[model samples]
Target chain A: MAVCPDFSIPAPFFYVNTFYDILYQSEDAKRIFGEHANFFSLIDVESRRKFQRLAERRFEPQKFELLLNTVQSPAMLFDIHLKWNRDNHCSILCIEQSQRYQQITEVLTRFTQRLGMTNYDLLRRKEELERLLANLQQSNAQNDRLVELGRIAASIAHEIRNPLTSIRGLVQLLAPNLTSSAKLSYIDIIISEINRVNSIITEFLKTAKPAPPLKEAIPVTDLFAELELLCHSESLLQGIELVILPVDPSLMIYADRLQMKQVLLNMLHNAMEAISDLPNSRTGMIQFEAERFGRYVQIRIEDNGVGMDEQTRTHLFSPFFTTKNSGTGLGLSTCYHIVELHGGTIDVESTPGHGTVFRIYLPTVDKKPELS
Target chain B: MNATHNNRFFQASLDLTDSIRMKIIQFAHILLSGDERKSWEFIEQQLVNGIHSTEIFCTYIPLAMTYIGELWIENAISVVDEHIASCVCDYLIMRYQAQYITPPDQQNCQAVVACVDGDPHELGAKLAVLLLNRHGLQTHYLGVHCPLHHFLAFISKWRPSIVALSVTQSHHLKKVQDYLEALQGLPYQPEIIVGGRLIHHLSYTSSKGAPNKQRLFFMQNLHELAGWLEQDYLPIKPE
Candidate 1:
């Protein structure tokens, strides 16, 4: 007799109206059946109870045959055929079939494991795809902003050039006839306004132009040190403390030095403006800090001042949206567009009573060259 | 000579009796085995041996066993794991189904198969495509959870004779109804057939609250669906 200790039959095998006596039993049978020499008696109470319940009812024997064939057992299933055979005094037949059950279970277990691995792989791939999609979306939004800025710059240039030419002509005409003191004062105002218009045009041109590729790594700490010296001179004259916190050393970013400096200057100017209207009783303090974030470097400029409400903050980076009467709102908006063009993001956090904090994140160079 | 003749007659009778018994045993065994692959193979072999397709599928023994297996096994494997197995079996079934292909003299037919919005399960939809294609119907399969507008546009363009919508989740019934409403206003509206586990859950009520009133046919399984499509929907010529 062929006896399989472990379930190894690839398919279920069934016997109808036949019973065989066991000549030899494997260790697995001994372990599973345990002390019961007769295979029919080896069935556990639960199996016997199910068998009994099935026998009591006018059960369709075929219905339970599939379940029987798929489970490991040392049990006998009695149906109408067997009942008739017993009534006729014919010997009942029992066969060893647990190997088939074990085989089916093993296949099912392997199938489930394979399914689980596939799901995990798919989930991981989906997450990676979502992240890439988010990055693409952000890049698209930045492109839209750049296009808007380009239109604004073109219109501003067209509008201001004619007025500037007319003003220059009028100033020259008035210069020849005025008294010396009056002439000097008038000329000074005209010259200053002319310079202001020229500076606006220069800034507009810088924003509209495509950025040159970054050629060298610039250390952020060194840049901030130089900015501190400039802020210190102005702060001392204005009676405000420009606190410069030295960031962690070895922090570097890939960017053009001149462009980065321009961005920082704009941020500093905004910070200074925010703190200018602080109550006399409270000391105005502007803080500069930097830190490394995952795949990006972050820089923050914080100031204690009369902060803006939600409405002002929402349109803070919009062109020509400003709180100051004398200010051209392009300062911060230009800073926003410039930072975005360099593949960086800027965010502002503020409460009505608490001061504003401008946080900027710039992407880090990949450790290895990206495979195309 | 008489004894020899008697022995031969007795032997022939026994052989004939055993043959019939073997057939019954094999039928029960296939049902009892409940392995979908084996049962499908048996059915295909029978068909190849000149058994009528309808007769081979008339008995629900295999499908019933499949239902039982589904119920007994907890946490059954996902569709992706079964895709390979399904594809192999479906290929075989498709081959048999191809026998019913419309001859050159018959008119061409077109159909659309899709999964309703939020129902990402496309196994049923895939089966529908195979069956429809095998029957010589040009089937356009819009894979899964297509937006209603896209479905409407495709319908407007293709003007298929029938549209089969499969829904695995019951919650998608609302979206499917909305899609049907959108189709009602269109210039061309195809007959919509619904199937899957969710269709079984839909309660029968008066037409007053019945959504998607125009086109709704509930099918139990792929086999039943095939029969329904062939008997009810396919255009037949007068003999």
Candidate 2:
């Protein structure tokens, strides 16, 4: 009995067990349908054909969306469920309900104002999740590094002790056979070899305990400029090309300028070495680009050198992890440590024959007060 | 609510200057960093007590958290940042909902709110549930995309005086229609309400249906819904 003009609920308040017969409808059903018509009959021609298929199959009453219309009412779509029953004489049943579509559009405009806030929060949580995962992995890697160091410590002590003992006995034995000058020369040779060993140990210590960078606001553009000038001679000597793309002059990062130079120089040297090691290596290319991205400044150094294999790349940043022989195997590791100290992330991409790319992201320095 | 009162409330509650808007965005970032304590404190400091808290929440969301889809299109914020801000807002809204107290003398009218299946957006529906409850209506919240069976089972058992169904996706509009179909045979007839972001484009609603003789009240926000409940349903003492 309650009704409004913009929306309608015109279900016939009647039930029919058979759609094919009208006799089954009781007087009340007849009266309601006679005036309002059966909800199914109110549907358009196309839908009745569709509804007939279900009735023909004697399927259970199912809801089919149809636009219902009557002489006095406007055309509106309703999910009307209809079925025919023939077991006891014949019967049919119908129901219809709908709202003005405009109502929903208005509601959506209101809801969108709120949904945006929910979305922003979800992304923040995702970033936290990634950060937490990274921290867990770093901790595990650190524990592994400690275990490796303990083993290396024992081996190093044995290696050094054996050499000193051999030198002591040999020196005493030679003391009787040689002139004073000859003895001094022989002792000098021994000292030189010992110094070589000491240098290797020093490299290991430097990697084991890295000092934090003294951060200052330095322009990333300047870093790229200095790097190009520094590597200019090296690139030419190795038949390599150095490309430095123009970047925003004001783009600045809070990092130790000296350490950042070291990070880039090491990467450039590695690129050259990789190219030289390859058979029939063409003229090498090392491209460096610096730019500000969101709250960070990114420095990307790419090279056309023989790249690392998956196995070598995995341990590329670990302390004392290196592919080069005849060195302490800690060049790249030292670079990584310096970058981390500046609150930056380093990512490396390499393909066996294709090339290598090192992308460094450093948090940009903002002197302005953060509102929140 | 009168237009003058609405305007006054909006102006008083959301004086969202550029600086305040920027600060709100910064707070969203802080909230994302899991500094819940600091974010709430910042909000409290900026939004003083004289402003109706709900009005502030309703009016200022547009400034602080613009439509995410539009933001992504404009490249103003990454999809992830927008998503994070949205999630933080949802959490804040839920925090507000938890503190909303029901009046002692509740109305006899009971309303059941449920989202149609396949539509997971529940913020609007949840707001309706919380606001209705605060206004002394006995409201039950059946969360996002409730299966049709569960919805019907609860409706039959509780026999609520009204039912609010929310669907945020157009594809899920079918579910809304299906629900209306199922609601037809109930002995205790309840007023049915459907809401969602894509509710306007609900396929069936596109038809040019002229005014019919059945009553259905459409509400765009809690304010409008609140007005209807107070004016028609709730008892009003002489003012």
Candidate 3:
């Protein structure tokens, strides 16, 4: 309303009365807020409240900040300076601070990028630590197993060595004395029995010092194929139906191939033996299956044979435990040890007249990251 | 272990007014008969039908075991039958817990559930572990008959925030007291939650002399325990 006065300052400046009537505006301010805009209409609500609080104080030179609506931006932050003149009108100056805000935003973006990298590094390191811990546990279990085996191996050697040697020597000496076919067959049986004893001793020694597992991702179907091939002849000989269910192609486990085969073979051998004892009138059958169960691969071997009682089931994994007449009592315990060494567990359930089921749960290897 | 299924297993849905109660009764009968396969089938079917796991655990399993206990109390079943039923229930609970896959990002709230020495019943403790685990807690279940020294050694190593003890027999009060005293001796004291069939015995002034009574809580049933866990104890959101 006053005659258009030229301001001395070059920055965006304004003069307004106590009611916020725009008495004067610099050319730059006019370009930003428009020619006829009120001072209150230029700021956001929050800044209006702040301005009201500031106005309640005594009229003096003051410096503050406000978010202003300008031609360039919706809510631009501005450093505002205000002073009251003798005419009771206030003169105001606003310095745009968008460049400073941009610098602060750049710093924050860098901070967040660094934080994300740190989180990824921490996760990678945690995975490494977990792998190391698993290896340490496996080593500890192996050491304990070796110590227990050493204790039993010494006594077993002392008990079997001299008798085995004498039996071999006697069989060789009597080889020429056998003239008839029936006598030759008896000598053959004696030699084979001695060889079986020697083989049992060797198998027991292998349990004492097992090679560390060469763990790798292996498809379960491939392993099952090998097992079916190896057990095919034995199943044919015993007339037991060995039915291995088809495994999922994507199911995989981290394990030693040879040791895993040994575990399956041992279980298959036990299953066949169990079925061989069944009556001829009843048909014998063994079912082998492997499936993904949560984070583990569950290998299940079930047999419709003469099952074991609770007492036998409890001691089935002991070092020198067996219920068979010609059994060495070492196969199952060795299987148990090998499974433990692979960071797996084996559980058995059986009813005396029905059947037995052996379930081996091994940790699965996840190939897809998104699946997790 | 027995993967084969047959008609004896319960696979059909129910249509009774009190379906949960009927299921509980039938499950108790199955457990008493030592038919684990049937019981597993029943549970799996329930889970497959979209029943909430909390209802299955906090209502079905515990209620079934309680019915078995009641039958044993009334002399309908022998002691051996009761033991067999308990063992079957324990095995199913073990298998069920083994199948739980916790989310990797969930922050763990550690808990230890055990039965006092000389208490033969562990179903209550096992159920507690299952329910707590379902609520985003990492629980270690030390089954019945763990010696005190071994327990203390484990507790010192594990240093859980909660210790849950199940006591079925009132005569095991001495063992509970011993455990409480030993737990108090540790550098980190956990909140002790005592619950079981004989939980009311503690309310009869016998727990006044127990060590760290301020930290002891008597939970009547799993529902109350779960409520407490949701309202006060569960520090993380349930998954």
Give the Cα lDDT of each candidate: 0.58, 0.61, 0.74
Error of 3 at A294 (Å): 45
Interface RMSD score of each model: 14.6, 16.6, 32.5
**DockQ each:** 0.01, 0.02, 0.01
**Could you give candidate 1's per-residue lDDT for residues B125-206 as a string of tens digits?**
7667766776667877787768778987887776777778887654466566565556567665466787775576665553
User: Which of candidates 1 and 2 reaches a greater lDDT?
Assistant: 2
lDDT of 3 at A134: 90
Per-residue alpha-carbon lDDT of candidate 3 for residues B74-143, written as tens digits (9 for 90 to 100)? 3355445665676667656655755564522324337888888867567778788888787777887787
Tell me the lDDT of model 1 at A96. Answer: 38
Q: What is candidate 3's TM-score against the reference? A: 0.34
Best by DockQ: 2
Q: How far is A201's C-alpha from truth in model 3 (Å)?
A: 66
Mark the regions of model 3 whose C-alpha exceeds 4 Å error after superposition: A1-372, B1-17, B102-109, B203-214, B234-239
Model 3 per-residue lDDT tens digits across residues A12-65: 899888787887888888877676547898885435655665544357787766
TM-score of chain A of each: 0.44, 0.43, 0.45
Minimal lDDT window, size 10, model 2 chain A: A1-10
